[model samples]
Target: MRLRSRLRGEFPRGWCHSAQWWITGIRDLTLNTTAAVATVVFVGEAKRALRHRDEPRTLARLSGTFEGYVASLLVNSGGLAVLVTMAIEEGLPVVLTALLAGWYLPNIAISATVFVVVARSRTRQPAAWAELDFVDQHAPKYGRPPETIEEYRAQQLRE
Candidate 1:
């Protein structure tokens, strides 16, 4: 009699469990994808800064965008907290929860450290607003900003 009743249920024999797994999986996937994109942008900006480290005013322009990166990292941390909470509340496997924490926790820490370095650099280099004004006047079209501030200044000099 028990077996017969189980078979007749709306979500027979673990189907409901499968549905919960899928929902959590989708949420995890979305969060990870967003984190990956933000990481790429942050890394790209770092590389650009390195490539022009010797040039005047480059740090200023780069610092202009680091705040955005820090903001996104904080938002990612909040999302991670919600994910961890969901995993615990929904009885998710321990390994999966551990993996998520292990992956993102250090990421948040390291990324914040990098932002701190960038912030310090901004303080040491204080010509950011002047470069910004240069950008405003020279790249007013917004479609064809120079690849680097050095390059833009050189182009402006030539013109």
Candidate 2:
């Protein structure tokens, strides 16, 4: 019957047709917004670390990794919830495949972006550290390495 087909997600179920709207909307509200906020904050902190020339890049990288994991977990779980809801409404065999794919694919792509940023930052940074060390050694008037940035600043002031 048409009812069975629609219930099983075999055909298009527009807005208000099935629980699809509710499920997707819920995830958008709960998981997506939170992920976006966390991503922004993490990125800002990473930029701050770079600006300050701090060695806490490792912490920033790990935090980025955690953010990616949280995003993946929430997106996949929300997608699965929607899929299960659809399957329950209709039938498992006919659950809309596009909905299933749509749910997690974007999150996977976003996670990959997070991964690439972390990796590239690590690669670019190691070389930059040598430059930092070089400056630390040569730019100090006495040709001595300062133990900390604060010490370096004090030496520069005296010079």
Highest lDDT model number: 1
Residue-wise C-alpha lDDT for candidate 2, range 52-139, written one tens digit per residue = 4334334342343444445665666577677778777867675366666564555544544555555556566876544443443334
- Candidate 2 regions exceeding 4 Å error are 1-33, 36-66, 69-91, 127-159
Per-model CA lDDT versus the true structure? 0.55, 0.50
Give per-residue CA lDDT, model 1, range 65-158, as digits (tens): 4545575577668868887888978987888888877766665764565566666655666576455545444441212335446546745753
Relative to the unseen true structure, what is the C-alpha lDDT of residue 12 in candidate 2, on a scale of 0 to 100?
Answer: 34
TM-score per model over all chains: 0.46, 0.31
Deviating ranges (above 4 Å) for candidate 1: 1-68, 87-91, 132-138, 142-159
After the best TM-score superposition of candidate 1, give how far the Cα of residue 133 lies from its true spot, in angstroms. Answer: 5.7
